[model samples]
Target: MTAPSQVDYHDVLQVWREADTIPEIEHAWLFDHLMPIFGDPSGPAYEGWTLLSALAAQTRRLRLGLLVTSNRFRPPAMLAKIAATVDIVSGGRLDFGIGVGSRPSHPLARHEYEAHGLPFHDTAHAVGSLAEACTVIRRLWTEAEPFDFHGTYVQLTGAFGNPKPVQGPHPPILIGGRSAATLRVAAEHADLWNIPGGDIDDVVRRSALLDRYCTEIGRDPASITRSIHLQVSYDQPSITRDAIGEAIDAGFRHIVLGLPAPYPADVTRWVTDELIITSAYYDSPI
Candidate 1:
């Protein structure tokens, strides 16, 4: 995963193109943010979905997407169309990831919404809207006929998606968030659930909560794959390898390694060699 901030497009493309050739690197990701969230506050931050589409067109074998799109960034119906277009562009390699927009606690993230003239709603509103957005998006992808939808957060009339996504039943829905509310939404809508990796105990606890929510909904908890995003450390590969091991032990089969900007030469290759390969070796039974 690369945060499309403080980096050049060519650099991201380079890394992705490299990763595409490496069988160990199964997917690549960009992040959703209109403004720079780290480093120089005013630094350039390319739009995620746009960059994702460009990358999708360029890469062939790697599954790709935003780490998770901010649901608040676009209307659900419109987002469905955009995702479908990307899926077509990528020949169906898109993993549709999304989440309730940034939390108010993160001041940097909060500023992007205000900067873009987008409303910053309360957490409850954001989570509720996200649930509605997921429902509307899935329907748009699968429903053959035009439909009307009236929900607390979404209202659509004669909404329909044409040129539907290449993936049958739509691309896999990967919802990222740690909140219980968001987990409940994932219980119903997400094919995969992702949370940032740092505190392994918290991740395990949340995974349990999600299992409970799925049980309550009469859905199999195992149906949703567990995913984690662990930041890569250029200086210390061992740290990342350890985190990967822990995440794997915690049942997170899908791991997204967040690569920081000013990406080193052959960084993707380095990631495959020093991180992914080593982690696999360490995780294997002796």
Candidate 2:
């Protein structure tokens, strides 16, 4: 994963090039925030889909995804088409991650939303809209005929999603967040669920809750894969190992991490040689 505050496009390409050297690294993601984060409002605000589209041409081996995008950023049908296009460009290496926009409490986030003329509402409303958005996206991806969508937040007439995703009916929909409504939506719809930096015990508790929700919905609990967006980075080698080790112990197979943007390229080799190479001998979590 990458957060592009200090890192420019050149740095991003370099990071991907270094990542290509590490065979154990299966996926790289970008954070999907609209504005400059970490208190750098003047920093270049890299959009997620644009970055993914560019990287699709440059990289070959690793799968690609954004950590999570807000449904409020684009219409569901349009997002579906974009996702399908990107997946096609990447030869079916896409994980469509998304979430409710975010809390309106953050200073930058609030400005980003209101400034863009997007809704700045409560978390509950956003979550409900996100659920509806996912429904529309999935329908567009899978259903061959045009259909109408009437949801609380989005309404469409005769919506169509042509040239379906290369990854069969749809690419993996990775739902973010651990709220009750969010979990229920994930349990019903998501192929994967991402917990963005949380305690292992808390993760375990929520995993159980997800399973219960899946069972309640008559869906297989094991259908949804578990992933974590780890806070550790390549620079802190020991810390990275310890954090990843803990996550592995807690039953997460897919470990997603965003290294600090402008770190030395050799940091990738350092991480691969230490944690990724060692972890290869272990059993798969899923």
Candidate 3:
């Protein structure tokens, strides 16, 4: 098994940045996963794009990105522009996670259409849209001049994205979802696949399936990174250390932890302590 390589923490804005001095923290910053069904509705409506810029400014030496951003929230062209801007702000520290949009009824079974607007929305339609969106994002990033694209869902004539992302070929694209359609899309387009928390058996199974999908699609399975998001509550003093180690042992290249909102001093304390110690531990490798 390939040894896993990283551990990431999510939703770190708990307590709203109150603590003593910010300690040196290492590891990827998994930004907001949701895109505000009610307009950035997570404690005071911090726009995801703005928050990412702030986080990048606040932290140094840590990679930053959204764990996953849904497709429905914005257009691909706009997303590409926003991501490029963030990448520039961070000096190229951004990684992006894209997914088929998720809304209230949670996949919106046809029966739940009434609850949500727009006929419960269709998963296949969303998936197809997301795939096309991915194509658009990449094309816009690489195209030297403003270009034209015509798609079933998106139509752009002479769209020029300026100040392209600092990262060559664009920041890494981490696609999220466990469905076959999602997997297929990732295989064709994504640089990484974000898997949510599950048991070891589940991880192994999903990993294998993803590998197979990549093979079927003529993609090099090794080229794609595997990132998992976990809702972790730690009892141990060195929780982050333990968590990162565990994830690495399980063959994940990247790991994301979902922390509560409101930014607690204790949360910062633990993260700082754990990150400093973990960096030391990994520096020399046991």
Candidate 4:
């Protein structure tokens, strides 16, 4: 995670209070989808990259990114350039998340794939594409001179990604998933690893596996930040506190609370008074 400047507690509260005015949030995330397959099925879905550019321009301190942008959604070079542009626009506050589009077999997911004419490849293909895409993205960001990439899944020639991200090297690459293939990708390339909420031992097991992968690949496991997403509603303070503590103990620094729709003001106040005030940590007020 990118470290933000220290601010007084009241200042953070002020940002929270101004909920409508560039609410000070630590990070904001978007989802990649052609339609609301999980919800309305026919409702509108914002194209993550376009909306993210808008968000980057609108906010000042909050980190803007996708929760997990599907690799199926864009070409590797194109997504890299889009991420770099947003990082520059937002003053280097992009947590660029990405994932292989290896979704579990579900009717909704199948429908989405059919609707968009996107291939619903097996997990192995997804994993391969993800790894190759990561390589291409990183190369575009770091290479000073144009280069060619010919991989099993992705190929590019005479490619150069200009206007590199404001973040040195590139913006934070946050990878999300618990599958072995996904974890391997995280160990190889991610600056942050995000998983769903689980018990302490769950984290321990996954971290150990990720560590093994990191070691095999000659990467330092400690270099990656651990994160998890926990669903939250207005009246679940106890759930929130307990989840946060569990995640912290399990070595996760970033806990993304999955806020169910129809956001509540009281929940925000409760978070400010209990979670934020008690911990005395700076967080985005989104």
Candidate 1: where are CA atoms >4 Å away? 280-286
Order of candidate numbers by lDDT, starting with the best: 1, 2, 4, 3
**Residue pairs clashing, model 3:** 14-261, 14-262, 14-263, 15-262, 15-263, 16-262
Best by TM-score: 1
Question: In candidate 1, residue 201 scores what lDDT?
Answer: 100
Displacement of residue 170 (Cα, Å) in model 2 is 1.1
True-structure lDDT of candidate 4: 0.73
Runs of candidate 3 with Cα error greater than 4 angstroms are 1-25, 28-45, 103-120, 236-246, 262-266, 272-286
* lDDT of every model, 2 decimals: 0.92, 0.81, 0.65, 0.73
Residue-pair clashes per candidate: 0, 0, 6, 5
- Give the per-residue lDDT of model 3 (tens digit) for 200-252: 56776777788999999888898988887765454554655565566667677
User: Over all chains combined, what TM-score does candidate 4 have?
Assistant: 0.86
lDDT of 1 by residue, 1-286 (tens): 9889999899999999998888888888898999988899988999999999999999999999888999999999999999999999999999999999888999999999998899999999999999999999999999999999999999999999999999998899999999999999999999999999989999999999999999998999999999999999999889998998898889988989999888998998898879876666444211
lDDT of 4 by residue, 25-99 (tens): 367566666566555655555566776687677667777678788887788999899889999998998998999
If both were scored by lDDT, which would come out higher, candidate 1 or candidate 2?
Answer: 1
lDDT of 4 at 194: 88
